[model samples]
Target: MGVICYTSGTTGAKPKGAMGSQKYLVVAGEIWCAVDNWSPEDDYLSYLSPAWATEWVLGLSSGLRSGTTLCFPEKPETVQSDIREIGPKVVFYSARMWESLNSTIHAKIADTLAPFRLMFNSSLKIGYRVIDARFQKKPVPLSWRALYKLADRLVFRYVRDRIGLSNIKWAYTAGASISPDILRFFHAIGVNLKQIYGLTEALMNAVHRDGDIKPESCGVALPGNEFRISENGELLVKPPACFSGYYKDPEATKKQFDKDGWIKTGDAAHITPDNHLVVLGRMKELIDLGDGNKFSPEFIETRLRFSPYIKDVMTFGEAVRPFVCAIVVIDYENVGKWAEDNRLNYTTFADLSQKPEVSKLILKEVERINSVLPDWSKIRRYVLMHKEFDPDEAELTRTRKLRRAFMVKKYKDLIDGIYSDAGEVMVEAAVTYRDGRKGVFKTAIKIRDVGGA
Candidate 1:
């Protein structure tokens, strides 16, 4: 019998049961063990949901094959503390989890004593300089190397210990595309964070190998896996541990594979000259502008999320539209600290998010991201969402991927206001409380146009 793992349904489509045989699962685990150099000596934290295929292949199956020690937190809320207590050697986190951790670290640093903050910032600057030199294949000066070691001992090590990642040996991030800036930040702090590219149907396909890491790419294909791009730009892969088909959905399963039997990954991707895989976004999720310009919303959104003040972003444009617009969700903790530091008082999330200072803060972040984007893909206008995108609200999937279609329909008024000359729009939103009670509230959300646009 095959094991069934349901898809996360990030596109707001019905979840499909992806079935993989026992042999396939074992082979997948063995492949990961070989690539990751897993051994009985390693300690792993089991935090990812078992319902996800990644957990099955990376945690349970691989742990069984490698005889690695597995640790679990007492509760979801205690994961950070538990990680510190256990000090696992191997760690895997989703993109959102990594981003949140980065935000938390920055917020904590901002609140620290000035002397310590200055030391930390100076240390990070040196680290970034070394990392930049290494990425560019330039030799680092001996003096810089000496300074980096001193900084690591004085600052980076402490930061790592506080975040419960001081002992981490193999840090992997997946589930969604992460900001390259975040990856670079971790590496600057002496963490060997690598990106993985895979899907439920294939278990695991590509992963960064030691010493060949690239923040912008998801590394080369794993051993016994092959990747190719189709005529329409969809990524096609043939992995050794491929799932059989979707359970009880033969028609849908049939569409997943091409006539030649390679699985159609439904993602737009390309291989670099050096064999690095760069996943752009979902094939259907690309935004086409009126002037025939096309860009991936994810491409822009992931970069924008690198800002500590922004939590979530959804970029919108279509063939009928001349320019792009966005809906931004601010990081309440970081932004709140910034507010208090500036002597701005706020009561609720809505009140804080709609503040004039907060709008300007987010606008600056948007412009920073726009600086790197193509002219046609630059965000012309944006609004700070009164509330965060909650998974309970179906704005995001369980894995934290945006449900774009659902969001577009749900926030039609906000999008309309963004496209128009409206200075602000009034929104009445329904929310689900922790006690399972439903409630509604109204707020006036302000929209801002980019200065250069």
Candidate 2:
């Protein structure tokens, strides 16, 4: 075997190492290059961990095969600056990273001078119209097209340059589910961001092609990969170069594939008549409200994350609870900036998170998401978390995918309070500092109801 890449463990289970032969890595790389249209002239940023299967396929194998120049950042903190300096043509980021970039852009615009901000917002409206028309396969109005061109010159161009995306030719986001709205936002701003879907066990399977982009789908299956939706709605794939098996784990390996040798993706999905692949959340992760209502938490969480104020969110609904509730993590930097601008004082993350004003701010965002959801699946109540989900704390994977089951166990009290009649819950959390010192603290976290629910 050429490599043994471990799954990200976002499903709240122990990660298994998927062994890949040299031919497997090579074929995966070749497929990626061909689908993304990589060439010798392209430049790529190498920021993802080497241990990741994606890095092996894109940075190592593909770089060698396509002869693309791979540039490494000086350090993790310097990635943005390095991108600004090097301006690589290709970049790949996880969903969280993409959301962070979107948040940063909006936060900066929020702080801009009133007149410039107004102009930018107006231009963006026109841009959105153009993007919508294009996605619907309708002709864009000439006036709207002209206005979009003007916007690109006056607003979008500057935004792209500031974010070091001016030279980005092919930007891809994966590793977790992302909001289609986020994809539309980027397209509206002239960034060619697309979603690609694959897994460690099954390499590259589907991607958005240049002229055939679908914000709501992961585009079509790659040239050498085939997809089939099983009887129970699980996405099954037969990739050109599937992973050999789980390292030293025969039982797990056997369970990964069906009798026909098709890899069971464990994700619910559908293939559209036009051959596009729309992946739902993990089958096991779907929330069942027991009253014949079921939904994907990721669908709601991704939309809520679009708000600059919300950094991360987890939605919960169970057989015992007919309505959905949520745990939200605020974007500390953005919220802190808002607090300062409004002359609101805060001492710590917990203090800032629990503030009445902050709760109102988050409530607006929650209501925005709830507006688009069904009555049965709407988030009726939510609590702003005291701190961000930490990978070191085992609440999130290194790739920033939530360990849902782990989080449920860890925050059992806070979740119970959301379903209960209580207005607040006392939360005692353990803290681990950078220097390895550990401590514990307690605080009262307020739960707010949405639309009197």
Candidate 3:
């Protein structure tokens, strides 16, 4: 029997169901089995919900087609422990989960004893160089290779085992773009981490091939998939596993394809000289600053979120403003630990954020990020939010994507303050809590100028 899978509803629109034919599922599975080098002997971890297209293709279809044994975690909370025990050969975790794992690993490393910490830090440096060389397809020097092997055995081997990735020969991150730092760290530690780019509409698009991986590009297109850049810079995909028309929505489906029958991906991307796909960002999400400087806020936001102290970010300055600024949400656990380590007393997230020390810490991070960004795209100033953006309040979508229009409308005053000469702004925000309780969150948010371009 056929099955129906609904969209994640992260586009701030009604979820549309896509019907999958049994034949189509088998074909999709066969494609993944071939591309990923899956075999009957391979053990696959079934984690992501089958509602997601990636899981449907990679976990369900491929598992069936390849005759691979599939294992499921006992419960949602026990996935990590179960992974450690099973040590599956293949994994397809979401980008967000990879970032969380990276953060957790770093936090654990930071808390280690001094001698072990020294070994871990040194081994990581050696490992990064080795991984970078391998990714570039350059031969590792004999001396460095020998040292890397030692580092891998002493530190990285244990780290990978602890993260339940020691046996992962084909680990993948998809669903959304991930930070390169996370990808690099995993590869450095010998996890063979790679990225796959696809959409719910296009089942399997592109993935990094072994020995040809790049942190910047999402690797070459699959054998049956073709990608072309449209005149307006949107990525167009033609794949064998294309979805049927949106359920009961022929008009929407008609608009999603061109006269030539290629599916419009709505993502801006460029193909590298090596035939790798380098996705920019959503074409509709580009911020055009009247004078011709246009950039994607997601690019800067992703880089900013690489910091452990920062949790969520929403950047502003499109048509109305000349420069960029951001609203930041701090990571409560990490920042709270920082506060406690420094003997700074803070009862709440709001109080901790307002502390001069905390502001300075975030300012340093912003400045560090600015050092590598182009002048027009750099965040000139930013305000730390006392409370995180909530999906219940429509600030973020169910999948944690920012609803730009909603954010612009809801935080107009805060946006105004960022452009103004105000050092700080008092905002009384009406928040909708998770329990459906409404309350006013009044806090004076500091707007620190990051001086240099």
Candidate 4:
């Protein structure tokens, strides 16, 4: 019997189902097993939602092909300890989850005592140099390599165990672009973090191999997959494992393919000389200012999200506006820790975000990001959002991608204040609980200027 799978519906639109034949599933499973070098003795974790194609294929179908043992956590909260216990041979996580774990680790590390903190930072520095050399395809210097070995024994090994990545022979992150900093950090700590580029329709297109890892690119295309860039810079793929079509949606199915048989991926990308694919955000999401300058909000957001305190960011710019602005969602746990250490009392996310000290802390992060960006692309102003964007409220997709247009419409008033001369603005917003109850939240959201810009 043929199988049907519904996408996560992360395109700020309605969900659609794709149909796949049994033959296709078998071929895909075999291909995945071969590419990852999966063996019968391998242990795998099934943690992500099975409704997601990546999880279903890799955790179920692929495991079936290799006769691998699979484990599932008791609950989502127990996943970390469960992972430590099982020590899976192969692991996959979406970029968001990896970033969240990165933030949590750094937040906790910052709380450590002086001697321990010094040792951790010093070891990481040595590890970075070794990994950097390896990424450049150059030999690691004898001294640094020796130092790294000692550091690994003393620091990185423990760090990896704590993070439940000590035994991960192959660690893959996909679904969305990951911060390069996060990838580098994992690599520095001796984790073989790799990026995968693929879609629900195509299953997988590329993955970073062991020796040829590139943190910036999503790695080279998989075997039996031909990828090319369109005239408008959209990534197109022809993978053997591609779905037949969108189930009961002919128009949508037809729109996915170009004049030729290649599937239009709707993502903008460029291939490096080494054949690694560097995805440059979605084509339709590019922002252009009136001054003949254009930038990818996703690019900027990725960099801003590297900050330990920034849980989420939604950047905005238009042909009419002179510069860009952002709505930032602070990492509650990390920021709350800061508040506690400073003896700042706060009852809620809304209250913490409105505090002048909190605004100042976020401004410093914005300035750090601004220092590396072009003048036109720098965020001149920003407001810490009172609440995190929720999928239930239609502010984000189920996969946690920002619905830019929807968010713009929902927070038009706040965007206006960002461009206005006002230093702060009071606003009332309605929040929806998971139970479907609604309540009004009112707060004076401060708009902070970056570097007097």
| Candidate that scores best on TM-score | 1
Which parts of model 2 are misplaced by more than 4 Å?
429-440
Which pairs in model 4 have colliding backbones? Answer: none
> lDDT (0-100) at residue 33 of candidate 1?
84
lDDT tens per residue, model 1, 283-321: 989877868789899999998988889899999999977
- Tell me the whole-model lDDT of each prediction, alpha carbons only: 0.90, 0.90, 0.83, 0.85
Candidate 3: clashing pairs of residues: none
In each prediction, how many residue pairs overlap at the backbone (N, C-alpha, C within less than 3 A)?
0, 0, 0, 0
> Under the 3 Å rule for N, CA and C atoms, how many clashes does model 4 have?
0
Rank order (by TM-score, best first) = 1, 2, 4, 3
Instruction: Supply candidate 2's per-residue lDDT for 80.
Output: 84
What is the alpha-carbon lDDT of model 1 when measured against the actual structure? 0.90
For candidate 2, the per-residue lDDT at 159 reads: 95
Candidate 4 structure lDDT: 0.85
- lDDT, candidate 2, 1-453, per-residue tens: 899999999878899999999998989888877877788999998889977888888788988889999999999798789889988898888889999999999999999999989988998898889998888788988888999999999999899889888888888888988899899998899988888889989887898998788888998998799999999999999999888899999999999999999999999999999999998899998988999989999889988999999999999989998699999999999999999999999877888999999999999999888888888888899999988898999999999988999999988888889999999999886655456777789988998989844
- Better-scoring candidate (TM-score), 2 or 3: 2
